[model samples]
Target: MGPRPEYPRPALRRAEWQSLNGEWEFGAGDEPVFDRRIVVPFCPESELSGIGRRAGDVVWYRRWFDAPEAERLHLHFGAVDYRATVWVNDVEVARHEGGHSPFTADVTAAARTAENVLVVRAEDPLSDKTIPRGKQHWTETPEGIFYTATTGVWQSVWLEPLPALHVTRLSLVPDLRAGAVDFEVDPGTDFVVTLDGEVVGRSSGQPRGRLRLERVEPWHPDSPRLYGLEARLGQDRVETYFGLRTVEARDGRFWLNGEPFIQRLVL
Candidate 1:
């Protein structure tokens, strides 16, 4: 089995998707000459990459994949450390900075039906303290607190096929006090709210509204409860789940679900 085979995004899921995590042609520097192979989703500095050594500040990754059939295709990267520049079929698709945040690029225009080439260029300077290198040591060897540094693509990369005019985003804000949940769908499309496979509320031609629950279930650590949600826009459908709960501070104490609760810190 390939590494990290699970779906990259669980909260927002679709039935059709493809995982792009596996071995790829790898090399150090800005040039495209890949002289070695490395397992993707694992930085070259890690043992899992088959090359337990640093690949310098700049590295290149090249891989080929068969394109999926859809009106639109979105290439998603769970994360790439520091900076990343991607090209699909030799056409620049995305350029992103920041190591921890996920990003996506529309590759419908650059993807070919039979096959496509994916190239990634990652830049992560070791001596630069300005970049956010959380827990990563600057020197070659790890010290007391700082650990081994990671460079290049260190997270899952996948492809998802999407329809034209599909739902772009979905936001759910739970209001425990009002026994309802506020929802906002992009492009103002109709949506249906379901709880445990049963329809509870719905809206037509409205993007933002509130859906009151008939029986409220407060989520707790012992007995966690969640509600299933499905939103549809045109031919696109997305499935997600949410839990209802509330936390607040009162009288210098933490309160959970309107009851005073003790807090524990483990940092």
Candidate 2:
């Protein structure tokens, strides 16, 4: 019960943050020298990353932080496993290959100024025939029920400080029978949305609009209602949360909005 300090990406949010998990300075690599200590986003084969073994294809992680003179300086990685190469004080910004999703790099010209020396070089390749090693288990010992391989930063790693036209992206589209909620912004300004704080929806600097909503409250699963979004463009402002409900599959059964939906076989 350590790690997991929250704010791992609540649907793209930013307000200047910093959380490069705990101790990092691992070894085995192409220029590694930082002995041990690992606990970031856990995945040195789990056990909350206290060095739970099996990691060596080329791994190396180092850490150091404190630099925020922002004008841009983003470095986020909530997933990394197949190939990640990044450096900050040593220059070389970012390079990712995908172990699941998120990836970012703009280390604003190598972290503003002061103290910043972040390095990461992970290249898993336990082989799943070309790579996409999902169910893990690349065998070196285990036999029957497979599942063991996972290396380098399993998720979470942060730092964001932007201001040069922020709000990179957000595209939500929920149309519960046309109650509307369709936004597509990525530089397209003028935005406003709220539900628990009023102001249902509004958009003028359109990049694509539609935010109608009057009383609509769908989102099923025993009333899992959620609607509390706040978005602003320019200097960026995000706080996403949405749920409008809609699931479909026609005649051959399965539907949620057009009716006929049944599941619970053993809840």
Candidate 3:
């Protein structure tokens, strides 16, 4: 869960994301504390924390960021524990339950220019039945392959800023034969695809502020091409990269890069 390189997960926009992954101050107030300082994203019970023990305690994390005045400041988490209550600048902003998926909260209203305190209170009732506890062993079995009970802040915590009116997402499909990629964008004003900050393709806009991507490249596998999208919507600009490739079936088999293929399943 450490700043997972893959973004636009579940398809929101990537260029609008800000990573809040790093050190965080933890408070094991009135809890059965274990050891000392712990790194973020990784659970307190894992070896990565540098303090590996069953410290299923509620932790507090604080950080600050400069948000665009026109941007909609958003807070996101890859995943939390059994239950988590998030507070932005000492104001409760989000409360989430369920340990399987992900969640987010917009803290624009409760934000200020000064320091912002992000406190997360987590609790896990050891015998949690409703949650999907995959690979996490809740019992007291210390070693052997199973693990100790890990509590709060078990995943990545981040902040993302969004443009007032922006392209939230884009979809691309590769046409191997054409050696280009097709596109579908939701740009509010205009969007230009770039690579390494160099403009490669662009889409125009209507006079009233609507943009549509009509002409585009057809992506092919051998080239393994991609288009870097830089869309300007008012004052906010979004950035993301899309691959031009397709997955298909041929003669009861899958094909990648327009070639006959055989998939592997080695376990």
In terms of TM-score, which candidate is strongest?
1
Model 3 TM:
0.68
Per-residue alpha-carbon lDDT of candidate 3 for residues 1-267, written as tens digits (9 for 90 to 100):
444445625343555565666666665654423335567777767777655766644554555655545357778887777688888877999999876568889888987755777777777756766666666676756466655666777677777776556555566554445545455666534667665456655666522222232344445544645556665667666566676455788789897656775766894
lDDT per residue (tens digit) for residues 134-165 in model 2: 56777644556667878778898988888878
Order by TM-score, highest first:
1, 3, 2
Q: Kindly give the stretch of ten consecutive residues in candidate 3 with the minimal lDDT sum.
A: 206-215
Candidate 1 structure quality by residue, lDDT tens digits, 1-267: 689999899888888999999999999976777999999899999999989999889999999999889999999999998899999989999999999999999999999987699999999999888998888999878999999888999999999999998888888898888888898888787766666677766777678888888767788877788887877788898888888889999999998999988877796
Using TM-score as the yardstick, the better of models 2 and 3 is 3
Best by lDDT: 1
Per-candidate Cα lDDT values, in order, are 0.89, 0.79, 0.64
Cα deviation at 177, candidate 2, in Å, is: 2.6
Q: In candidate 2, which residue pairs clash?
A: none
Q: Is candidate 2 or candidate 3 better by lDDT?
A: 2
Which residue pairs overlap in candidate 1's backbone? none
RMSD each, Å:
1.7, 13.0, 5.3
